[model samples]
Target: MEQQRSFGSHTTGTLYLVPTPIGNLGDMTIRAIEILKTVDLIAAEDTRHTQMLLNHFEIKTKTISFHEHNTQMRIPELLAKLANGETIAQVSDAGMPSISDPGKELVRAAIDAGVPVVPLPGANAATTALIASGLPPQPFLFYGFLPRKAGEKNRELEKLAHESATLLFYESPHRVGKTLAAMQTAFGDRQAALARELTKKFETFIRGSLSALQTYAAGDLKGEFVIMVEGAADKPAVDVTVPLKMQVEAIVATGAKPNAAIKLVAKQNGLAKQVVYDAYHELEK
Candidate 1:
C-alpha cells in the first residue's frame, strides 16, 4: 500500500499526466496547458504530433519521445531527471496519457521511486461515447483495443460474452466491420452504438443492432470507432446431457475444422480448450 498527496511538497519533482484534445483543439483544458508550459520537460508519444499542440497553444516546453518502442531507454532517463527535481509532463498524441497509450510504465516507476504523480481529468473517447450511447452507463467495462489475431480475438470475446456490464471497445475503421460481425456471433444481435470522428465536425454516432452496425461499417470506413455493446442477459445453462466429444463432432459436421469445432464447443459450454480437446480425442485412444 502506498500513500500519495498529489499536491504535497516533496524533494523530487512531480510527474503531471496531462490530457490533450482528441479532435477539437478547444477541448484542451487551461490547467493542462499551464502544466505543459511549466514542466521542465514533456515526455510525448510523438514529439512531432505534440509539437503541433504546443505550437497551437504557444507552449515552448521541450519534448522527448517516449513511446512503446523506446520505453526501456526513456523510463530510466525520465526517472533520473525527476530525481533531480526537474518536473516532467507526460502526454499522448491525444486524449489522456496511458489509456491504451504510453506513459503507464513511467507512472509506475515514478510511484515506486516515491515521486508524486498528479493526474488531470479531461476528455476520454470511451466515457464521451458511453454517455451519448443509448445504453446503460452505470455498469461498464472499458476494454480498449482487442487482440488482432482472429483466434485470440474470438477467445477474448467468448470470455466477455456473459459479462453484465456494458462493453466498450476501440477499433480502427478498416476493421470495424469485421469486429462488429465477430461481436454479433459471440453475443448475438444485441443493441449497440458506434461513435467516430468524435469532437470533429464530422463526428457521428450510429445506434442499432450489431448486424446493422456491421452493415454501416462496410460502407465508407473512416475515423477510429468507439463501440458500445449492451451487456448480455442472464446466460442460459449449457446442456450437459450430450457427451462433450459428440458436441464437438456435431460442430465439425457443419464444415468447421476439427480444432475450430473443439474451441467453439468449449467456449459455448464454458469449458477450457484443453479439457474439450481431451474429451473430443479420448474416443480415439
Candidate 2:
C-alpha cells in the first residue's frame, strides 16, 4: 500500500491528472488552467486537439503526444522527466485522463516509481448525463463502452443483465440502435435514457423504454451518446433454476433458430458455446 500526500516535498516531480471539458469550453476549470500553465510539460492524447484548448486559454506550455498507440513508447520518457523533477500534466482529448483513455498506464508507472499522482477533478460526461438521467444515482455502474463485435457485446450484456445498479455506457450514434436492440434482448423492456451532445448547446436526452430508444436511434445518427439503463427490480429469492437444454428449447420455441437459441443459452449461462452445442445436440439426439 502506498500513501500520497499530493503537495508534500518529494525527490520526483508530480504527475497531475487533469480533466478537460467534454464539449462546452466554459466547463474548463480555473485550477485546471493554472496547472496546464505551470506544469513542466503536458502529455496529451492528441497534440493538435489539446493545442486548441491551450490556444483558447493562452497557455504556452508545450505538449507531447501520448495516445493509445504511443503509450508504451512514451511512458518511460515521461517517467524519466518526472524523475528529473519536471512536473508533468496528462490530459485526454476530452474529459478526464485514464477514464477509458490512455493515461492509466503512465499513472501506474509513476506510482510504481514513487512519484506523486495528483488528480484535479473537473468535467465528466458520464456523471453529467447521469444526474439528469432520471434513474437511481447512488448505485450506478459506469461501463465506458461496449464491444464492437455483436457476439462479444451480447455476451457482455448477458453478464450485466442481473446487475442491480443503474448502468451507464458510452456509445457512438451510428451503432446506438443496434446496441439498444441488444440491450432489449438481454435486459427485456427496461426503461433507459439516451443523452447526446452532453454539455453542449444542442444537448438532448431521449428517455423511454429500450425498444423505443432503439426506434429513435434508427433516424439520422448524430453525436456521442451516454446510455443510462434502469436497474433490474428486486425479486424474492426463489430456486427457479432450469436445465440448460430446457432453456435452449424455450428460446427456440420463441421463433429463434436452433443455433441462435444455443448461442443465447451459452451466453446467459456463462458457458462456452461448444459446451452448449454439445448439450443441445445430445438433447436433440
Candidate 3:
C-alpha cells in the first residue's frame, strides 16, 4: 500500500483534484481558486466550459482539454509534466472531478507513477442532495450513474435492491423518469428524492416514494438530477426447516408478484437471486 502526505515533501509535482461549483458560483471554495491560480496548468474536462468558470474568477491560468475522448493520449503527457515538477490541477465542468466525470484515469496514473495526488474538498451533487433528501445519510452507496442499456440497468438495480444503505445516482433529465420507474420496479415503492438545478436559482427537489417521483419526472424535467433512494429494510431470518420455494410462495401469497417474492426471499436468505428464482420455478417445470 502506498502512503501519501498531501502537502509533504515530494520530488515530483502534485496532482490536485480540484472541485468546482455544481451550479452556484458561490459554492466554489477559496482554496480551490488558489490552487487553480497557482498550479502550473489546469487539465479540464472541457476547456471551453471551464473557461467560463475561470473568466468569472478572473483566473488567467492556462487550461488543456483532458476529457474521455483524449484521456488515453493525455495521461502520459500529464505524467511527464508531473515528473518534471510541473504541478497541475484537474477539474470537471462542474462538481468534483471523477464523480460521474473525467479525472479518475489520470488520478490512477498519477498514483501509479508515485506522483502526489491531493484532493480538495468542495461542491458535489450527490452529498449536496443527500443532506436535504430526508433519508438516512451516513451509510450511503454512491453509484454515480447506472448503465444506459435497459437490461444492464435492470440487472444492476436488482443487485442493489437489497442494500441497507441509502443509494445515490446521477441521471440526465431525459432519462430520469425512466430510471425512477425502473427503480420502482426493482426496489419497490421505497422513499426517494430527486434534486435538480442544484444550488442554482431554479434549484428544486422532489421527495416522496419512488412511484411518486416517477410520476413527477414525466412532467417538465430540467437540469441534471441527483436521485437518492432509501435502502431496503432489514430482513428477518428465513426458516431453515422450510424449503426455499415454499418460503417464496408464502411471500407471493401476500400479494407480491412471483418474481418480486423470489427476489425478496433471495435477499432475506443471503442467496443469489438466480438460485431462489430456480427453486421457485421448480414447481412450474
Candidate 4:
C-alpha cells in the first residue's frame, strides 16, 4: 500500500493553504481536492463547516479546528506533525484563509520555523468585487475591513480619499449603512460601488456617488457588501503619473490654493495625504 506521502521527506512538511469557493461548491479545484485529501491532517477555520465539505467529496482526512481563537494554541501540534514529516492543509469556511479570517497566525509561524508554504489560490471577495466594480480599476488598496472604532475608520478613510486608484473594502451586512455613511463623510461626492452577495443568487451591485450609495443601502440592504470607492475624478492638467511635488507644482501654477491644490492633487493622483503633502512641501521650497 502506498503510504499517502505529501511533502518531500528531505524537506519539512509543506503547508498547503487551500482556497474554497465563496458561494458555489463547483468552484473547488481538482488540485485543491488532491492536496486536501492527501494531507496528513487539515486545520479548518470551522470544523463543522469543513466536515460537510469533506463528506461531499468523501475525503475522510483528519481535521482539527484552527481559527483565530484556537490557532495560537494549536500551532505547536500542527508544527509537530510537519516536523515529523507529515503535511498539513488549512481551509476557511468559505474563500481563502487569512483574509479577514483566521489562519494568518499559522502561516506566520510556519514561515518563522522554515517550513515551506504553498498557496492554492482560488476565490477571494476583494478580487471578485474589483473585477465587477465597473470603476477605474487597478492600483487599488485592499482594506480587509475598516477599523472597528468610528474615529479610526474615519481617519483611515480621510487618508485614502486622495488616492487616484480605487479603494476596496469588505463590510458585513450589519455595518454596511454605517460604513457607507462614514465614506460619504470622509470621501465625499465620490462615485462608489456597493457590490453585495458576490457569486450568490441574489448578488447585487449598486453604483453611484457616496451619497447615492448611502441612500441605496438605507433601504433593506442585506448580505455582505464589497464597497469600491472610485479614485478622485479627473482634473485639468494635473498629471497623475508624476511625483507628488511636480504634480502639485503644475496644478498650483494654475492659480490653485495650497489646501485646494493639496486636496485636488491627492484626488488627481489618487494618492494619500502624506504622499501628496511631502510633494506640496517640496515644491514650496
Give the per-residue lDDT of model 4 (tens digit) for 14-59. 8999998887778889999999999999999889999999898889
| Tens digit per residue, CA lDDT, model 2, 37-149 | 99999999999999999999999999999999998999999999999999999999999999888899998899999999999999999999999999899799999999999
lDDT winner between candidates 2 and 3: 3
lDDT of 3 at 235: 77
Candidate 4 yields a Cα-based lDDT of: 0.81
Q: TM-scores of the models, in the given order?
A: 0.85, 0.86, 0.90, 0.79
The 0-to-1 C-alpha lDDT of every candidate, in the order given, reads: 0.90, 0.89, 0.91, 0.81
The candidate scoring highest on lDDT is 3
Instruction: Give the local distance difference test score of model 3.
Output: 0.91
Tens digit per residue, CA lDDT, model 3, 45-113: 999999999999999999999999999999999999999999999999999899889999999999999
Relative to the unseen true structure, what is the C-alpha lDDT of residue 281 in candidate 2, on a scale of 0 to 100?
A: 79
* Candidate 3: segments with Cα more than 4 A from true spot: 239-257, 266-285
Task: Give per-model CA RMSD.
Answer: 4.1, 3.9, 2.7, 7.1
* TM-score, ranked from best to worst: 3, 2, 1, 4
Best by TM-score: 3
The window of 10 residues in a row where model 4 has the poorest summed lDDT is 1-10
